[model samples]
Structure formats: structure tokens, C-alpha cells
Target: MSKITVLVVDDHPLLREGLIKILSLDDDLEVVGEAGDGETGIKLVHECRPQVVLMDINLPKINGIQACKVIKEQYPETQVIVLTVYEEEKLVLDIVRAGANGYLLKDVEPNTLVQAIKDAVCGKAPLHPKIAGKVLHQFGQMAKALDMNNGPLLTNREQEIVRLMAKGATNRSIAKELFISEKTVKNHITNIFKKLEVGDRTEAVIKAMEKKII
Candidate 1:
């Protein structure tokens, strides 16, 4: 079996070294490289081509989310698992939108962290239970709004557009994924905006979530 190669990225020297030490104990995992900041992390990830990247959100040069975006954009095969002290829902949502596969807090046990890495490598998202609960509550609020109407609404295409837009995907990316022309996408977006009574993508997504359209 091929061992999983991982790149550790943290602004703190001790944290980076500590994560490497923790991950090194796993027979199936290898710490291929380390970076003290996000820019260097991005460079290392590109150079190492690791299967999994354990990254910290608070970095020096750039934020982890931006680095994840760059790395995932250039190397879609690489999986990033955010390791940080933050438990903010918005940050979690942002990182996920940026293409991170998992989110693990720094307080997580070494064994659990190792398991998260393994899960991420296999394309599974692992979130702390508390974090997951918070996410569920967020979804539940949306669900409640969606069920508020007498009957279900929103066509499948509108739903798709909202989901992509909510995740901060570019119109071009959405068009490619939906296999629609850019003009067609713009047309659909306009229609979606009109139906949602929203003027822009951000507002549209907010409205869609409130209606459980996504």
C-alpha cells in the first residue's frame, strides 16, 4: 500500500514540529514537508505534491483558506485538512468553500488527528462533533425556512446555482460544472436573482439558504 504523504503548514514553529511529530508515528503516514507560513506552504505543497496537507488557518504571509484555494486550484488532487484553534462557523464554511476536505481543531488527540488525515486522504470530511453539531444547527435553520411554505419550491437548476454560488465558486466554474454556456449561466443567474428577489450572488445565496433552495 502507498503511504499517505502529508505537508504540515503552521506559522508557529512548535506547532508545525508538533504536528509532524504526531503524524510521524503512523506507519501509513509520512510528513513530507513543513512550512512556517501560508505562502511557503503553498510552494511546498506544489513542490512536494503531497496527498494530504495539514494546514493552520492563522499564517504569516497569507491565510490558510487562500492557500488552500491556490493549492486546490493548481493541484486538485491534493486534499487539505485545516488544523487550527478556531471553531468559528464562518471560517469553517469559508475553508470548505475554498476546497478543504476536513477541519480539525488543534486540541484534537494525536490518534484522532491521524484518523482525520486518513479520512481526508480518502475524500471523507471529518469535523469535530461539536463543529458538526453547529453545522447541523445551521442547516436545520435553513430547513425550517424552506418548509415554511405550504409546499416545496425551487427547480433543480435554481437549487444547483444557489449551491455553487453559496460555495463562492466563480461563474465560469459553475458554468463548466453545469455544462452550460457562460451566457446561459448568466441568463440563469439573472432568472435566479429575479425569482429570489436578490440583486447579487451573495444576496441570492442568503435568500436561497433562508428558503432551503440549495
Candidate 2:
């Protein structure tokens, strides 16, 4: 099996070293490169083209949010996980807006970070538990009078899947809850996004609320 290639980016030398060490313990993960600043991180991303990037919020040059945006725009397939200590709601929102695949704290357990990388590569948005609540809260505040004049309607199953999605449930969790396979859950979410005309889980939630579909 091919191991997941990762790039560690942070200003702190000790932290970057620690993260690389943790990644080394995982048989399925490989650290392809490391950087001490966001500019170098971005350059390394171009050079190494790792599968996932562990980005820190406070970088010397570009900063995590902007770097993440650059990566997503330039290489959407390369997942970026913001590994930061800042958990402020606004920072979470900013990182999410910049298209981070996951938001995890520096204090996260090594095993959890490893699992988060795997989950992220699998297309799951693995937010820290606290950050998850902020995203959910943002969705909660998004209800509006929907102009459904051209909006497509979702089937009952799609509604169920999306509702779970709004609750920040993973594909695995949604499948287990609905007694379906993960592939089936993914299919449902794909259909939901298509019907809702949204790009991601966050947009789907907001669109669902706008239509009062959930």
C-alpha cells in the first residue's frame, strides 16, 4: 500500500520536529518535507506535492489562512490541515473559509492527528470538537427566506444524510447511523450537493436551511 505523503509547516522548529516524529510512527503516513515559515511551506508544497499539509496558523511570512487559500486554489487535491493552537471562533471561520480540510489544535493527541490526516485524505472535514460546534453554530445562524423558485428538491434519503451532515457527522458516522455503507452515504451527499447546488458540507447546510429542507 502506498503511504500518505505529508508536509509539516510551522515556524517553531521543535513543534515541526515533534509532528514529523509522530507522523513517522504511523505506518501509512510519510513526511515528505518540512518548513519553518509559510512562504517556504508553499514553495515546498510546490516542490514536494505531498498528499496532506500540516499548516500552522502563525507563520513568519504568509500565515496559515492565506497559504491554505493558495494551496486550495492552486492544488485542490492536496488537502491542508490547519494544525494550530488558536481556537478562537473567528480563526476557525477564517480557516474554514480558506478551505482547510481539518482544524486541529497543537495540543491534539498524536494518534488523533494521524487519524485526522487519514480522515482528511478520505474527504472528511475533521474539525476539532470545539471548532465543530462553531461551524455548526454558524450553520444554525444561516437560515433565511429561501428563494426556492429554481432550487431543486431533495429526496427523503438525501434530506436525512444532509441533516446528519449539518450536525457535523462524518460519512462513517452517517452510514453507521442509517445502517448503510460509507459509499452509499457518500453517494447521498453527492446527490444532496448536486440538488442543493452547493459545493461542500458547509454550503449544503446553509442551502438546506435556506430551503428549510432540514
Candidate 3:
């Protein structure tokens, strides 16, 4: 089998080297490049076309969130896994919105980090337990708020779509997960927007949280 090419982007030289060393031990993975900042990371991504990127959120120049956004926009096929020490809810949400495939804390077990890279390549989102818990807690709070507010009741399917949207899943990913066509996902989103009195996905998510529709 072919190796999964990877790029390591972090500001710390020691951490970057350590990651490369760890990933190198996995026969199925190859560290093809490294960058110390977000700008260079993007440049290396374009140059190397790695299948996976291990990115640090607090990088110099553009910062990892912006780099992830640009990389995903320019090369949707490339998967980015954020490796950082931050466990803040807002940062987690921002990284997801920027199209990161996974979020792992800096202290993650070596084996778990390796597996996260593999999972990302398989189109699976791997979020740190703390980060995932925060997202789930937020969702749960929204559900409870919806109950208390007596907001417009959404169908089970619509609620599912809204939940997925809040998790930052693309329409394509949502369709695949729901076993429906992309067109169907779009239609559902349209109905959801109308019901929630929102415009786009971001606005819909905000409104859903504010109104507790999801």
C-alpha cells in the first residue's frame, strides 16, 4: 500500500521535529514536509500536496485557522488535523468552521495522534474528547433551551441536519452521513433556514443557538 503523505506545520522546532519522528515510525505514513508558520505551511501544502496536514493553531504570519481555511478552499482533498494546546470552545468551533478535519490536543498519546491522522484521511472527524464534550454540551443546552422556549418544533430530520450543520459538516458530508443526496441536504437546509428564520449556515447556527431550535 502507498504511504499517506503528511506536512507538519508548527512554530516550535522541537515539537515539529518530535512529531515528524513519531509519524516516521508508522510505515503507512510519511512526513513529506514541515513549516514553522501558517504562511509557509500554506506554501508547503501547495508545493507538496500532502494528503494530510498536522497544523498548529497558534502559528506566526496568518495563523493556523486562516491557513486551514485557505488550504481547504484551494485543495479540498487535503485533510488538516489541528494539533494545539487550546481546548477553548470558541477555538474548537472556529477551527471546525475553518474546515479542519480533526482537533487533537498537544498532549495526545502518540498512537492516538497517528490514528487521528489515519481517521482524517478516511474522511472521519476526530475531535479531542474535551473539545467534543464542549460541542455536545452546547448542543444539549440548545435542546433544553428549545424545550423551555417552546420554539417552532422541527422535524427529527430537520433537527438532525441542523445539528450536523452546527458541528461544521459540509453539505456533502452531511448527505453522506444521512445516506441522502446532496440535493436532499440542500433542500433540508433551505427548509431549516425558513423555519429558523435565518439566511446562511453560520447565521442559521447562531439563530438556532439563540432561539434554541437545534
Every candidate's CA RMSD: 8.3, 3.3, 5.0
* TM-scores for every candidate against the unseen true structure: 0.68, 0.80, 0.71
Indicate which candidate wins on TM-score: 2
Off by over 4 Å in 2: 144-152, 164-191, 200-212
- Tens digits of per-residue lDDT, candidate 3, 43-147, equal 999999999999999999999999999998899889999999998888887887787878899989999999989977765678888888986676666576565
The deviation in Å at residue 34 for candidate 3 is 0.2
lDDT of 1 by residue, 1-214 (tens): 9899999998898878888888888899999999999999999987899999899898888999999889888887788888888988888778866877778888899999999888666545678777777665776765785665633366788788778765656678788999998788888888887887755564566567667666
Give the clash count for each candidate: 0, 0, 0
Flag the better candidate by TM-score, 1 or 3. Answer: 3
Candidate 3: the clashing residue pairs are none
Residue ranges of candidate 3 with Cα displaced over 4 Å: 142-214
Model 1 bad stretches (over 4 Å) = 143-214
Q: What C-alpha lDDT does candidate 2 achieve relative to the native structure?
A: 0.85
The digit string of per-residue lDDT tens for model 2 on 1-214 reads 9999999999999988888999999999999999998899999999999999999998998999999989888888898999888988888878877878789987898889999999888767778888788766765565444454546788888888888876658899899999999999988888887887866776687678767777
TM-score of 3: 0.71
Q: For model 1, state the Cα shift of residue 10 in Å.
A: 0.4
